[model samples]
Target: MEYIASEALINARASTVWEVITDAGNLTVWESGITAIDGELRNGGTIRIKTADAGGRTLRLRVQQMPGEVMTWTSRLPLGLLKRTRTFTLSLQAGLTHLTVKEEVSGPLAAFLGNTRPDTSQHLNEYVHAVTNRAELLDRAS
Candidate 1:
């Protein structure tokens, strides 16, 4: 399996951070490289995402959420050749929100496709910073 993860301590409540992450319409504002999202981010729902990294390919993901705590997006290749699951977890700590985003890639072809997978460490850091900045801004405004 391949894993990429990022975390941040934002000066915002968990609820506020959750709202920011779950708002699909404004996702592109904070999520770097994501060009568009075409569906709601509710549990048991599916959303199609267009990203600059994919070269115009749209990624379809299944959404799973645990309200203000966790949200996970899963995508799979045909015949279970590869599967990727990205999870966002939020927790309250010392009146602040602790956010963690993790992505795990696993399947029979994982080893074979290692070279083809993009290195997302930098992207993950950017994502964490973006979320923290946006959540803190909203927290201050409210």
Candidate 2:
């Protein structure tokens, strides 16, 4: 499996950060890489996200699991040759929220596409930064 992940400690409540991260309608406000998102973000729901970095490919992801502090979304490439799962986890540590976003790709095509895939590491970092920055900004405003 090929993996890309990013994490950061945000000085905010876990619930506060979770609210901002899970709200599909507000994703583009903080995540500059994402141009738009359609559909809801709940267990069993489906969401389609359009991103700038991924050559504007609309990622249709399903909400595999969504609990209070963690959410998992899964997507499959054409012909089911490749599958990708992205997870977001949050926890409170020492009065700060530890946020993590991780994506794993697996299947027959994973090895072939691993090297040619877009800048996943950079995108992951941007995701983390956006979430943390938004959380901190909202925390201060409240």
Alpha-carbon lDDT of model 2: 0.86
Each candidate: what lDDT? 0.89, 0.86
Cα lDDT of model 1 by residue, 15-88, tens digit: 88999889998988765558999999999999999876676889999999999999999999999999999999
Each candidate's root-mean-square deviation in Å? 1.2, 1.4
Best by lDDT: 1
> Which residue runs of candidate 2 sit more than 4 Å off their true CA positions?
78-80
Cα distance off (Å), candidate 2, residue 77 = 3.4
Q: How accurate locally is residue 85 in candidate 1, as Cα lDDT from 0 to 100?
A: 96
Q: Evaluate candidate 2 by giving its C-alpha RMSD to the native, one decimal.
A: 1.4
Clashes of 2: 0
